[model samples]
Structures are given as C-alpha cells and as structure tokens.
Target: MSALDFIPELGHRVRESVPRLGAATRFLVLGLGRPFHRHFSIQQWLRQVYGFGVLSLALMVVAAFFTGMVLGFQGYYALVRFGATSALGTLVALSLLRELGPVLTALLFAGRAGSALTAEIATMKATEQLSAMEMMAVDPLAWVVAPRLWAAVFTVPILCVIFDLVGIFGGYLIAVPVLGVDSGTFWSQMQSNVSFRGDILNGLFKALCFGLVVAWIAAWQGYSAQPTAEGVGNATTRSVVAASLAVLGLDFILTALLFS
Candidate 1:
C-alpha cells in the first residue's frame, strides 16, 4: 500500500478509538463519584488508608531527607556568591513545597503503590476473582475501588509532608555541618522567610490531587485489563506511565492557577 493509503487507514482507526477513550473516561468519573459517598464502609476505608499512609511513610521520609540535603548543598554556594545566603530558607521552602515534595512523593507512590494496586487487581482479574465478585452481586466499584481511591486522596498529602520534613532536615544537616551555618540562625531564617500558608497548603494540595490521579489511573487500567497475563503486564506498565505524566501535567496547570 502507498503511504497515503496507510495514512487514511490510520485516521479511520484513530476515530474508531475515540469512543473507547470516552467510555473509559466516563467509567473513571463514575468511579470517582462514589468514592466519597456515605456508604463507602468504614472498615474498608481504614484498611486502604492505612496501607496508603503507613506503608509508604518510611520510604517518603528517607527520600525527602536526602532530597532536602542535596538542594541545600547545591543552592548554598550559589546564594553565597550573590551575598544572598539568607535566601536559602526561602529557596528550600519554595522548591520543596512547590516541586520536590509533591513531585517526588507522587512519582514514588506511582511506582510503589500504583504498581502494587495494578498488579493486585490484575492478578485478581486473571484468577477470575473479579468475575466471582460480580457473580455474587458485589459491586466491585464499591468494595474495591472506593476505599482505595479515598485512601490515596487522603494519604498522598501526608506523604508529601513526610517528604518535606526529610528534605528540610537533610538541608539542615548539610548547612549546619558543612557550611557552618549557625543552627539557630538557619531555623530563624526559615521561620521568618517561609510562609506556612503558601508553601504548606500548596504542596498539600498538589499531593492530594496527585494521589487521586495515580490511584484512579492505576485502578482504571487494571480493572479494564484484558484477561491474559501479558495484558496484565501491559496494564501495569501503562498505569505507571499514565499516572506519572498526569501528575506532571496537572502540577503545571495547578501551579499556573494557584500562583497566577
């Protein structure tokens, strides 16, 4: 076939796929709608919340601590040259609150929790457990998706806080030990320079949105996976890619909206 012939054929398939995308989007919205309702079961909610929060806490802490230290070391000398060493706190606060805290935590959560959720659901689908649930008249949306979605929404911001704490401590260690910054002065600068409302709230907001995106993407992908091992593998991979990209895209949009 000529190249032009192939192009027309491709356009036809692209148009055909649009409806499937729309269907998926609709299903996603439905899933999100019921996640916050009164019937969303306290027991199930507690389980997923604990899983999302407590399970991920240690990892977030370590990651943030190291991230903070690196930011401090990297920014310190640059600020010193401009006689703006006092700007370190503002720099750390802004960078962590705006970028590193939410982004890194989301990426980690996508890799860890997102993958786990995808795999778990994919495995269940493969084993026909999902089918069994349907046969029993149990709404998988209510029993499976709602709790996890809400849990992720609530847990992500908490994880972001953990990330911020670790990152700041890392900065403190590097600044105090290596740069010889007076501990009291460094903390005082941070307190005076960093506005809690702007920095903390913005970061937490980003984290919450990221959590929702990651969980929904992973769940939607996994739940809709074809009934084959290879399909499950593909779903898992796609879940991570989609969640990460969405997190980045949403962050940019949120930044513009919040800051503008």
Candidate 2:
C-alpha cells in the first residue's frame, strides 16, 4: 500500500480511541465530585498525609538549605555591587515565598510520592486486588483515591513550611555569620519588607493546589492502568510528568490572578 492509502487507516484508529478518551475525562470529573466528603476519612487521610510528608522531609530540607544559601550569596553580591544591598531581604522573601518554596516542593513530591503511588496502585490492579475490591462492592475511589488526595492537601503545605524555614536558615548562614551581615538587621529587614498576609497566604494556597494536582494525577493514572507491568511503569512515568506540568501551569495562572 502506498503511504497515501495509510492516512485514512490512521484516522480510523484515532477515531476508535475517542470513546476511551471521553471515558478518561469523565472519570477525572467524577473523582472531583463530593471531593470534601469523600476525602474525610480521618485515619486513612492522616496516614497518607503524614506518611508522604515524613518520607520526603530529608531531601526537601537539604535542597531548601542550599537553595537559600545560594540565593543569599548571589543576591547579596549582585545587590551590593549595585549599591542596593538593602533590598536583599525583599528579594529573598519574594523569591522564596512566591516561587521557590511551593514549586520546588511540588516537583520533589511528584518525583517521590507520585511515582510511588502510581506504582503501588498499578501493581495492585495487575494482581487482581483492585478487581476484587470492585466485586466486593467497595468503592475503590473512596478507599484508594480520596484518602491520598486529602492527605496531599494536608501534607504539601506543611512540607512548604519546612522548605521555607530551611531556605531562610540557609540565607541566614550565608548572610549573617559568613558574610558579616548583622543577624538582627537581616531578620528584621526580612520581617519589615515582607508582607506576611499576602506572601505567606499566597504561598500556602499555591502549595495546597499543587498537592491536589499531583495526588489526583497519580491516583487517576494508576487506577486506570492497563493490566500489565509495563503499563504500570508507563503510568508511573506519566504521573510524574503530568503532575509536574500541572503544578507549574497552575502556578503561573494563580500568580497572575492573585498578584496581577
């Protein structure tokens, strides 16, 4: 067959996949329904939230500390050269509270927790456990997906706090003791120049949204995975990619809406 003859066949195959695509979209919306009530299983939600939080803390702490230190050194030197050293606190607070803390935490969580969730659920599906749950009249969405989503909602903002604290300490170590910045002057400048009500609230809000996106993508992909180990691996990879992209995209939209 000539190449021209294959075009119609390709289009036919694409048309055949439309229903599956529609079904996927429907599933996503269904999961969002009654999100609050479905997510209210206190014990399960607590375990999921805290479990991911504790597991990922070490990496986040190390990353935040170094991030703060580098920004302090780099920002301080550049500002001092321009005779604008007083603005260092403003820059640090704005950068960390608005961008670095939430974005970095979400990326890290997607790589760590997102991948784990996808693999875990996908494996269960492959082993027939998910099917058994369905046969027993237990709603897998409630038993599996809701708790994770709720947990992420709780966990991610808490993680952001850890990120901000470590990052501030990193800046402290570089600016105060090392660079001879007066500790009191540095902290007071941070406090005086930063708008806590706006910056802190916005940062936490972004973190919460990021957590929901990450958890939802992970759970959705895993639960809908095909019955093969390869499918599980693909779901895990896609979960990370999709979750990270959603976090960044949502961050931009949110920043514009909130600040602009």
Candidate 3:
C-alpha cells in the first residue's frame, strides 16, 4: 500500500478502537457504581472470590516456592562472594516482598483466573445469555462484571501475601539446611532489614494495582467480545497477554512512584 493509503487506514483503525475503549471504560465505571446504589449479592461476590482467588492458590504457591528457592540459591552464591552470606535472608525476603511476590502472582492470576473470566463471559455472550438477561431488563454489568472485579481486587493482595510467606519459607529451607546458613541469622537479618511499610505494604499496594488492571482487562475484553466462538477464544488469549504486559509495565511505574 502507498503511504497515503496506510495513513488513512491507521487513522480509521484508531477511530474504531477509540469508541470500543470508551465503551469498555464506561462499562467498568458503571459496573463499579451500581453495587453501591442497588442490592449487591454477597453470594455472588463470594462465588466470584472462590473462582478468582481460591481456585488459583495452588499455582501461586508452587510458583512462589520455586521462585524463593531459586533466589536463595542465586543470592547465597552472590552474597558469599562478598563474605555477606548472612544477608541471604534479607536478600530473599526483600526480593520476594518488593517485586517477585506481586509480579509473579499477578502473572499467574492472569493466566489462570483472568483468562477463565474472559472465556466465561465471552461464552455467555456467544450463547446469547447476556442478550436474554438484557431482554429480561437485567443489567449484565452489575449482575455479572462487578462482583468479579471486586473479588479480584480483594483476593489478589491476599494471594500476594501468601506468596511472600511461602517464598520466605522456601528460602529458609534452602538457605538454612541445604546451604548451611544459620537459621537465627536468616530470620534476624530479614527482621532487621525488611520494614513493614517499605517492603510489605508497598508490595501489597502493587498487588492491588495489578489486580485491578488484570481484572479490568479480562472483564472488558469478555464483555466486548464478538459473539462468536472464535471471538471468545481470541478474547481469552488477549486478556492473558494484555494483563501480563500491564502487570509488568505498571510494576515499573508503581516502583518509580512508590520508591522514588
């Protein structure tokens, strides 16, 4: 194609995408707002929590455990070079709490819960379930989207905490018995060096932000998906890819904002 032809095509694509983006944003805003003004079903929220949070726990734990062990193995060797092997605990704890815990947990959540959410909603759309609800005068955003979004927002931080704890133990297991580091020194160094506000709270904040991004992307993609089988599959794939990128990109921005 000629340059002039490409320019208009690009502009047309941008114009088409802009409205879709706006519609999704409006859906999210409305979804968040409706629960406050109407009857918010606790059961529905709980179900979503179980789906988004509880179902993904095992994967998160395994990821966290191996991550910690790898950190312990790497950090021990690195610190040993400088005669600072005693700092292994602080290193592992700080790495997990500050970065790996939230980042990896969100990535796992995106792949598991987030993709499932996109697929479920897209399938509902494909099957005309959402249309039937609309015919029955039910708002799909309030009935379907809000609970999942809020559930993710609440659950992700808790998962991140679990990940951090499991990771610490994993580090201890390797650092103490396997590597011959003193248990007392590991715990003591971590306790002394890692601050509650600086490490733990900041990491939780990152988790919350990541959760919002992942859930929002998943819900929006599903809600806006084309009502076809292929479209549903595409939406699910996009949700995972988009959520992962957003988690990593936002992590950098959050780190700059929180640490700077």
Task: Flag the better candidate by TM-score, 1 or 3.
Answer: 3
Error of 2 at 124 (Å): 1.4
Model 2 residue pairs with clashes: none
Question: In model 3, where is the ten-residue run with the lowest total lDDT?
Answer: 33-42
Give the higher-lDDT candidate: 1 or 3. 3
Per-candidate TM equals: 0.91, 0.87, 0.95
Candidate 3 C-alpha error for residue 73, in Å:
0.3
Q: Please write out the lDDT profile of model 2 over residues 56-143, one tens digit for every residue.
A: 9998999999999998899899988887766676677678888999999999999999899989889989999888988987766767
Worst lDDT run of 10 residues, candidate 1, spans 31-40
Q: lDDT for every model? A: 0.86, 0.84, 0.93
Clashing pairs in 3: none
Residue 17 displacement (Å), model 1: 4.2
Off by over 4 Å in 2: 1-29, 32-40
TM-score of 2: 0.87
Pick by TM-score: 1 or 2, better one: 1
| lDDT (10s digit) by residue, model 1, range 197-239 | 7778888898999999999889888888987999899999999
For candidate 1, the lDDT comes to 0.86
